[model samples]
Target chain A: MVDVQAHLPVLIVTVPLIGGILTIATGRGWKPWAWATFLTGTVFYFTIRLMMQVLASKTGMVSYELGNWPRQWGIEYRVDALNAFILLIVGGVGFITTIYAKLSVEKEIPADRVNFFYAVWVLAITGLLGITVTGDAFNVYVLLEISSLTVYALIAMGKDMHRGALTASLRYLILGSVGASFILLGIGYLMMITGTLNMQDMHDRLMSVPGILESRTVLVAFAFLLAGLGMKMAMFPLHMWLPRAYTYAPSAVSALLAATATKVGVYMAFRFLFTIFGVGFSFGMMPSGLVLLLCASAGILVTGVTAIRQTNLKRMLAYSSVGQLGYIVLGFALANLHGIAGSVAHIFNHAVMKGGMFMALGAVVYRTGRCDIRSVRGLGKQMPLTLAAFTVGGLGLIGFPLTAGFISKWYLVQGCLERPGGWPLAAVVLIGSLLAVVYTWRVVEAAYFQEPDPGTPPVEEAPLMMLIPMWTLIGASIYFGINATFTGHIALTAARSLLGGAP
Target chain B: MTGVLGIYNYWIYVILMMIGLYGVIAKPNLIKQAIALGLFQTGIFLYYISMAVIDGGTAPVWTTVQDGAQKFQGPYDNPLPHVLILTAIVVSVSVLAVALALIINIKRRYGTIEADEIEAMDIADRLAEFHAGAAADAVDEAAAEGHGLEHAHGGHHHG
Candidate 1:
C-alpha cells in the first residue's frame, strides 16, 4: 500500500501537471476536462489542508525525497507550515479563479482558444505549486520561468488583440526572463561554492565557508538574486510592465496573475533569504535587509501615490498591487518574528483580497464592456449585486473593519512597532493604507455617485458562475477578518518554521 | 598575465551588460528595446561561460577507444555552467521570439513601434476629442446669442 500522506506534496504538484496535459489533449470539445482540471485544483487544496492538519498535529515537518535519494544528493520536496500556508493561498485562489474563469472566459475569449487557455492556466498553476513545494534551488528557477512563460502567452491573448496586449506581454516576458536568469546565475554561483544544489546542504556549507563572508562574489550573487526577484514581484522601480499587462490581459488571467503570481515570487525571495542564505547571514552579515527596506519603502510611497492618479479601474488596481507587494516586502525586511508572521499573513490576506477585487472588476467589465471609471457610471443601480461585491472588495482594500485587509495591516503595524527603529516603518504602513483608501474610494465614487449617461442601455449583473466565486472570495475575506485565529495560527507557526525553529 | 587576461574578460562582460542595459532603458523603439534585451541576456551568457573556463581545460567528454580514459589532460572546464547556460539560452530565445511577434502585432495596430509615438498618438487622440467637444459647445453658444439678438430686434419692431 502507498503511504498516501508521504505522497501528498508531490501529488499537490503532479495533479495539476497531469490535468494540464489532459486539458490540452482533450481539446475544446470536452468542456468536462476543464472542469476536471479545476476539480483537481480543489482536491489539491484539500490535500494541502489535510497536510497542514497533520503538520499541526505532529508539530513536525514533512520532507519527501525524490527517487528515494538521500537529502544531500537527490532532489527533495519539503513542506512545513510556511509552504503549507502558502499552498493554501495559491490553491484556494486558483480554485476560485478557475471557477470564475468558466463564465468570464466564455464572454471574453474565443471558443477555439478556451481549452488551450485552461491548459495554460493549469500549467501556470502547476509551475507555481512546483516552485512552492520544491526544495531544490535550481528547480525553483525552472518552475518560475515556466509559470512566467505561460503567463505571458495567456496575457497576450486578451480581447483587444491589439499590440498593446502583445507589447505589454512582451515587455513582461523580457523583464521576467532576465530576472530568472539572474536568479539562476546566483544559484549557479552558490553551487560552485558549495558543490550542492540541495538547499539545506547549501545552508550548512555556507555556514563554515571561510572568507565567503567577505567575498564580493557572494555579495554580487545576492544582489543579482534580489534584483531579479524584485522584478518578478513587480517591486517599485521595476513595476512598469504590470499596469499595461493587467489592463490588456483577459479578465480571468488578470485575476489569477494578480492574485497569485507575485506572491509566489515573494515566497521565493523569503525562501532564498531565510533558508539558503540563513537569516543571521542575510541580516547581520550583509546589508540586504536595509536595502530591501529602503526599496520597499519607496515602492509603498511612490506606487501608492501613482495608483491614486490612474483613471482606468484595472490599471489602478494593478498599481495598488505594486503597493501591496511593498507592504509584504517591508514586513519581510523587518526580520523579526512578528514581522515575518505579518508578512506571511499578508501573503494569504492580500491574495484573497486582491483576487476578489479583480474578479469583481472582471464582472463589471463583462457586463459593461469597459473597465474605465467613466464607463462604470451608475453601475450601482444597474449591476447592484456585482457592485456590492466590488464594494466589499474595495472596503477590504481600504482595510476597513471586518475585512481581511485589516488583519494584514494590523499585524504589519504591530510587527513594525515592535522593532527598535520601526516607528518610521509603521508610519509608512499607515500612510500606504490611507492612500489605499483614497484610490479604492475613487472607484466606489464613480460606481455609485456618478449619473448614468442618457442614451446608454442598462447593464445586467454578471452571470451566476462569476458572481458566486466573487462573492465567495468576498465573504471569505470578511470571515477571516472576523475570526483570524485560523490564519493567524498558521502564519505564526509558518513564520517560526521559516526562521528555522521547531515551534 | 593569463590571470590578468581572465580578469579583463570579466570587465568586458560587465561593459557589455552595461551597454545592453543602457539600450533597454534609453531606446524608444520597441524592437530596438527587445534587441537590447537580447544583448543583455547574451552578456550574462558571456559571464557564465567565462566563469566556467579553466587553464588549458579540455571539453567535458570521455573516449571509449582509450579504454575508458577521460578526455581531458588538465582540469576540465565546468560543464555544469555550460549546461545551465544552454537552458537559459533556449528560454531567452523563446522570450525573444514571442516579443518579436508582439512587436510585429504592435506595428500593425499602432502603425509605429516607437514607445513615444504610441504615447503621443494616444494623448493627441484624447486631446483632440476633448477640444472638439469644447468647440461644439462654443458654436452652440454663438448660435444661441444670434437667435436672441434677432428675437429682441423683432420684438422692438412689434412694439
Candidate 2:
C-alpha cells in the first residue's frame, strides 16, 4: 500500500469532491449544512497533517505521483512551503466560512436551492485547493475551469437578492471561460516546447536547454499566461467583472472567494515567473517586473479612490479587494525577498481581514434586508459584537499600527526601499493607504456616528453562530499582527524556497 | 499552393475565434452573446484538434497479438492533445449551458435581453434607491426622541 502521507495529497482534493456529491444527496434543510461542514472540517484536518509533515521534512516539499505511473507521463502533486502556506489559508478559511454559511445562506438563497448551494460551494473550494496542490501544468488549467464554473453557479444563486446577480454571473462566466481557455492555450504552447506537463520536470528540462528561452513560442506563452491570469485576478485594467461579481454573490460565497480565488491567481503568477520560467530569465528577457510595477500602482491608485464613492457596502468592499490584489502583485513585481514574503503574509492577512468584513456585512444584511450604507446607521448600538468585529477589520484595511495590514505594507515598502531609486514607489504605497483611510472611515462613520432611521424598528444582534466565525477571523488578523513570527516565519521560509535552492 | 493549404487549419480557427469575440463584445442581445461565446470556444477546440494532426500518422490505438496488426511502428498522431481537447470540450459545453441558464433568468427579471436596456433599468432603480435613502435619513432624524430635527423638514422637501 502507498504510504499514508502520500495519500494526504490526493485526499485533500478528493474528500471535498466526494463531499460535494454527498452534500447534494443530503438535500435541503439542515442536512446539507451539516454534511458540508463536517466534510470541510475533515479536509482541514488532512491539510494540516500533510503540511506538518512537509514542514518537518528537510526539503520543505511533499510530492505524490499519481497511480504509480511513469514520472513524465503521470500527474504529480508537489506541495512546497509556498503552496503549503496557501493550503493553510484555503483550508482554514474554507472551514471557518462554512461554520457561518448556514444562516447567511438561508436568508439570501431560495429554499429549494440551499443544498445545491452547499454542494457547489464545496466544489468551488475543491477546485481552488486542487490548483494549489497540483504539480502539473495542464492540471492547473482543468482545476481553474472547475473552480470558475462552480463559482458562477454560486454567484447566480444570489439572483434572489438582486436581478443584477444574474448578469454579474453571466459576465463572470464569459470572462472566466475565456481566461481559462487562454491558460489552456498557453499550456499547450509550453507543452510543445518542453514536451512535459509536470511542472518540476519542465523547470529542469527548460533550464538544461539553452537558447529555448529566446524562442517565439516561449514569448507567446509568457504573454498569454500573464494576460490570462491578470484578467482572472482582476489585474488593474482588466478588473471590470470583479466588483459586480463580489457585490452580488451570496455573502458566504463571496467571502470564501474573495478570501481565496483571486489569491490563487496570484499564486499561479508567482509559480510561472519564479518556478517555471526561472526568475533570472523571466525578468531579464522582458521588463515584466517594471510592467507589473506600473500596472499594480495604477490599480491601487484608481480602485482605492473609486471605493470611497460607493454607497453599497458590498460593492465598496469589492473595489477595495481589487486594490488589495494590486498590493500582492506589487510585492511580486518588486522582486525582493522581503517583498515576496510580504505578499505571502498579505495573502493570509487579506483572507482573514476581508473575509471578516464581508461576513460582518452579511450579518448586517441578514438582520436589515439591505446592503446600502444607510442601512448601517447606528448599527454599533444595535449589533455591538458584530460592528466591533467589523471595526477591527476596517482598521486593518486602513493599515493602522498594530494590525495585519501594517505588517504587510511595512515589509512591502521595505522591499521597495531596498531597491535603488525606490523611494517613489514607496510614496505610491503611502498614497494608496491614505485613500484607504477615507473609504474605511465611510463605513465606520455610518455605523457608529449616524442616527438610525426612526421608521426602522429595533433589531437584535446577529445569531451567535455568525458572530463566532467573524470574531475568529478578526482575532486571527490581530494575532498575526502581534505575533508575526508565526505567519512571518513561514512567509520568509516560503519566499526563500521560491527564490533559491539554499536558505 | 501547398504552403497556403498546410496552414489553412490555423487560418480557419483564427477567423472563427475573432467572429465569436465580436459576437460577445458587440452584440446587444444576451442570447447572441452566449452564442458568440460558443463560437469562440469552438475555435479553440479546433485549434487544439489541428495541433494533433500528423502528416502521415495513424490512430494511436495499439493492436493486440490476436489482432495480427503491427501499425504501431509508424508515427502515431499525438494522443495527448486529443485527450486534452476532450476535457476542454466538456468544460466549454458546461460553461455554455450555464450561460444559457443565466440568460433565461435575466429575461425573466429584467424583461429584456438587450444589454443596454438592462443597464438603463439598473440606473433607474439606483436613482429611486438614492431618493428613498435620502427620505429615510430625514425621517430618522424627525423620529428620534430629543428633537424637531432640522433634517426632518427635508423629508417632505423632496418635491
Candidate 3:
C-alpha cells in the first residue's frame, strides 16, 4: 500500500491515458462503453485515494519528480488541496458522465465510430485530470492541447445531429489553437527569464530577481497568459466559441465539457495567478485584480441577460455558464479571504449544478430528439422526474435558498461586503441571480404550462441509466448545500494557502 | 536604435503573427482560415526558436574536454525550447489535420467550404424553425416573451 501510495500521482493520470488507447480495441456494441465505465471508475477511485493522501500529508501537499531526476531538471506531479479538490471533481463528473454516455452515445453516434468515441472520451478525461495534477508549467500546455484536441473530435461527432456541429468544432479549433499559442508564448517568455519550468522553482527564482515584476517581458507574458486563459475559460468578451460548441455537441459530450472543461481552465488560471506569480506580484505590483473584477462584473450582467434570449435550451445553459464562471472570477479577483473562498466553493458547486442541468437536457434530447424551447412543451406531465430534476437544478442555478448555489452566492456576497466600496458588486450578484430566475422560469413555464403540439409524436421518459446519474449530481448539489461544513472548510483552507497563510 | 534592431527576429515574428491573424479574421473561406491558423502557430514556433539562440554558440551537445583544458569550452544554445517546440509542432500538425477533416465534412454536408455561405445556411435554418414555432406561439402569447422578440423583428424586417 505504501509503495502504491507513492505512485498515486502519476497513476491517476496514466491509468486513464493507457486505458483510453486500449478502449479503441473493445470493438462494437456495449463493450466499449463498459470498458470506459470501468476505466473511469478506477480513475475516480485513484483520485479519491490521492485526495485522502493530500489531506493526510503534513504539508497539505504532495510532490513527485518524474524518472527519479532532480526537480529542476525533470517534470513534476504536484497535488495540493486546491488541485486535489479539482481532481476529485473532474474524476467524479467524468465517471458519472461516462455512465450517462452509453445510452446517449448509442443513439446519437453511428455504430462503427462508438469505440473511437469512447477512446477519445477517456482521453479527454485523462487530459483534464492531467492538467489539474501536473506541476510543470510546460506540461500544462501539452496537456491543454491534448484535452482541446480530443474535445474538438468529440464536438465534431455531433455532426449527425446538426451539421452546425462541424462549424462549431472548427471555430473552436481555430480560436483554441490561437489561445493555446498565446499561452505557449507566455511560458516561453517566463522560461527565458527564470531558466526553469517547475512551477515552484519558477516562483522562487521570480521572487529573488529584483524588480522582475516591472520588466516589460514579464508584463507582456502576464498579459498573454491572462488573455489566453481568459479565452479558454470563456471569460466575458472572449467567450465567442462556447455557446455554439456546447449547443451543437452530443448530449453526453455537452455534459462532460460543460462540467469539467472550463472548470479546469479556471484551475490553470489559479496556478498561474496564485502559485507561480505570488499574490503580491499578481495583485499588488500588477493591475490584474481590478481588470478582472471589472470584466467579470460586466460579464455577469451581460451573459445573464443574453442567456434569457436563447431559443435553444442548450445554448441558454451555455450562456448561463459564462455568467456563472464570471461569479467565480469575481470571487477570486476580490483577493480577500472570503472572496477567494467563495471562488473555490463555487467551482465545486457550479460543476455539480451545471453538470446536472446539462445531463437533464441530455435526457430531454434523448426523449424528444431536440432541446428547443418548443420541444419541452408539456413535458412536465410526460417526463415528470426528468423535468423535476431540471427544475431543481435550475433553482440551484438561481441560488435559491437550501440549494448548493446559495452557499456560493452567500459567501460571494459576504466577500463583496467585506471589502470597502464593494456594495455594487454585491448588487451585481443579486441581479445576476434575478436574471437566472428569468431564464429558468421561461423553461419551467414552457414545460409545465404549455400544451404539446398535436402534430408531433408523443415522447417517453428518459432511460433509467440517464436518470440515475442525473440525480446523483443533483442530489450531491443539495446535500452539500444544506451541510456546508465540508465544502466551506476546505474552500477556506484553500483560500488561506493561496493568500500565503499557513495551510 | 541598435537595441531595437538587435531583436529583429521578434519583428519578423510579430509580422507573421499579424498576417496570420488578419487571414483568420478577414478570409471567408474555411480552408484559408485553417491555413492561417498554421501560420500563426509557425510564428510562435519561431518565437521559441529565436529565444533559444546565443551569439556564436554551438549545438547543445556535451563534448569531452582536452587534457589542457580545465572545463569543456562551452556557450551552447538553450536546447529546451527546441525540444518544447518540437512537441508543439506535433500538436500543431494534429490540429491542422482535424481542421481539414472538419472542413471536408462541412463541404460534404453543406456543399460549400465558404464560412459566410455556411453561416447564411444556418441562419436560414434557424429562421425557418422560428417561423414555424411563431405560428404555434400565437396560441400561447405569454410564452413569446424572450426568443420571440428578436426573431419576430427579423421576420418582419426580412419580409
Candidate 4:
C-alpha cells in the first residue's frame, strides 16, 4: 500500500477533528473560516480516495487498525461500499457547507464568534465521519454524541439572531440525548449477549448464540435500536422537534445538518439491522416489517399534509424532510433488493437536492433577510440566481422527470410492486409525490406569479462564494439524475451486499 | 438463588432508565428535562460499567510473576466495557453541558425555563407576525390606489 493510502480512513475523520482545534487556536475571524474550509476540502479529497479504494478493492472492504493492535482488541475502521457512498455524501456536503458558511454566517451571526462557528462546524463534520467509518459497535455511540453535541451548539448559536432558535435547540438537545442514551442502552444489551464490541466479531458470535429467535434480550435490544434510531432520524411520531429546529437554525447549519446528520442515523439502521443483527432477525424473527410499514406510511401521509400548512418556507421544507424520510424507511420496510436500492438512492439524491435547496434558501436569507413565503414574492425577478437554484432543487424534490427525486421514487415504486398485493403501497408513494408537488408549486407560484412586493427594497444576487457552492450541489442533483451509472451501480452493490448472505 | 441475585443489577438499570425516561417525557422545566436527559444516559453508563465486571476476576491490570513459577491463573475482568463506558460518560457529560447552555440561551431570550410558557410565547409571536403582514399589505394597497388617483388628476389637468 502507498504510505498515504494506508492512513486514509483515520485521516478522513481526524483531519476535521484536528482542524476544529487548529481553528480554535487561530482565534475568531477570517482565519478560522480559512482553516476550516481548507481542512474540510482536504478531508473531502481523502473521503473520495477512500471511496475509490473501497470500490477498487477485490474484497470491497478497507480495514484500518488504530494503534496497530489486533482486530478484536483494536479500534478499527472498516470501510465498505455502503459507508463509502455515505462518505461521499457527508464529506461532499461538509466541503460545500464550509464554503457557504463564510458568507452565510457573516450575515446571520456576529463576526467575533465566527471562529467558534467553524470550530464547531469541523467537529460536527468529524463526528459524522467517525460515525460512518468506525467498525466497533461502541465507537458508534461515541461518534454519534460527537456530532449530536456539536449540532446542539450549532443550533443554539442561532439564538443570538433568532428569538426561538434557543428553545428549538434545547428541545433538540433533550430529545437527541434521549436518543443517544437509548442507542447506548441497546449497544449494552448486544455486548452482554455477544461479549464483543467489534461489529464483525459480534455478528459471528450472534450467529452461534442459541435461542436468538425467542430471546427477549435480543428482542428488547432490537426495540431499543429501532426507537433510538427512529428518534435520531425523526421518524414519524418522534419528529416534533425537527421543523422548529430547522426553521429557527441559521440557514448554513440547517443545510449542513439536513444533508448529513439524520442520514448517519439512517445508515446506522442499515448497518445494525443487516450487517450486525442478521437480516432475518430484523425482518423475519419479528413483525418489524409490518410495524415499519405502518409507521412509514403514516409518516408519509401525515407529514405531507402537515408540510402544506406551514407558512415559513424552512419549516415547510423541514416537514417535507420528515415526509421524504418516510419513503426511505418504506424501502427498508419492503425488505427487497430494489427497496434497499431505492433507500440508498434517495439517501444520495435527497441529500443533494435538500443541500442545494437549503443552501439556496440560505443565500436568499443572506440577500433579503426574511424566511416567510410572502417575502419571496417576485424574488424570481430580483434574486434570480438563488431563485433559479431553488427552482431546480424544488423540482427535483417534487420528483419531476429528469430530476434526481424521480429516479428514487421510481425505484421505490418498483420496490412496492415487487411485493404481493402492493398497489396500495404504490398509491401512497404517488400521493406523497403529488403532495410534494403542491408544496413545491406553492413556492414556485409565489416566486414567479405573485405580485411583486412593494414593501421590501430591491435586492441583488448572493455573493459568488455562496452561489458557487450552492450551484455545485444543484448541478450534482441534476448530473446524478441524468447519469445514474455511478450511483445506481453502487446502490445495487450495497443492497446486494446487505442481503448476500442469509441465516 | 445466585442466578436471581445476579439479575438484580440489571433490574436497577431498568428502573433508573424508566425514571429518566419519565422525567424527560413529563418534566415541564427545560433544565429539568436536560437533567433527565443526563440521567437517562447515566442508566446506560451504569449498564456498561456493570458489564465490565466478571464474577471471579480481578481488575484488568497485569501482575508481575517470577519466571516459570507454577501459579493459579484466573481470568481478568473485561476492560473493554469499562473503556467504552468511560467514553459514554464523557459523551453524557458533554450532552449535559450543551443542553444547559441551550437552556440558558432560551431563558435569556424567552425569560422563562418553562416549556408551556415558551410555547405560548411562540404562538403569540406567530400571531403577531401574521397581523403585521396583513397590515403591511393593506397599507401597500391604499398607497397604490392613491398613486393611481394622482396620475389621473395629472392627466385631466394637462388636457
lDDT accuracy of residue B25 in candidate 3: 94
The residue-level lDDT of candidate 2 at A46 comes to 83
A28-102: candidate 2 lDDT, tens digit per residue = 798899999998898888889887988898878887888877668889888888888888889989999999999
lDDT string, candidate 4, A325-367, tens digits = 9999998788898988999999999998998889988887887
Give per-residue CA lDDT, model 2, range B5-81, as digits (tens): 87798899889989998998999998899889889989988887887888888788865556675545558888888
Native-referenced DockQ of model 3: 0.34
- lDDT, residue A22, candidate 3: 97
Cα lDDT computed for each candidate against the true fold:
0.79, 0.85, 0.90, 0.83
Residues B65-145, model 3: lDDT tens digits: 666555445698888899999999999999999999999999998899998999998887677666756675564444344
lDDT of 4 at A32: 85
**Tens digit of per-residue lDDT, candidate 3, span A1-503:** 45878998998888899999999999999999999999999999999999999999999999988888888899999998999999999999999999999999988999999999999999999999999999999999999999999999999999888777889999999999999988998898888889999888888888888988788888888899999999999888899999999998999999999999999999888899888888897888889999999999999999999999988899999999999999999999998989999999999999999999999999998887668898899999889889998999999989998889999999999999998999999999999999999999999999999988655567788889999999999999999999999899889888998888222
lDDT of 1 at A445: 86
Query: In model 1, what is the error at residue A44, expressed in angstroms?
Result: 3.0
Model 3 collision count: 0
Per-prediction TM-score of chain B? Answer: 0.70, 0.79, 0.77, 0.78
C-alpha lDDT of residue A68 in model 3: 87
Pairs that collide in candidate 3 are none
DockQ of 2: 0.34
Residue pairs in collision within model 1: none
In model 3, how large is the Cα lDDT of residue A429?
96
Which residue runs of candidate 4 sit more than 4 Å off their true CA positions?
A501-503, B1-6, B63-73, B141-159
User: Which 10 residues in a row give candidate 4 chain A its minimum summed lDDT?
Assistant: A494-503
**Interface RMSD values for all candidates:** 14.0, 6.9, 8.1, 11.1
Runs off by more than 4 Å, candidate 1: A1-4, A29-36, A39-43, A46-50, A53-59, A159-163, A501-503, B7-12, B53-60, B65-77, B122-159
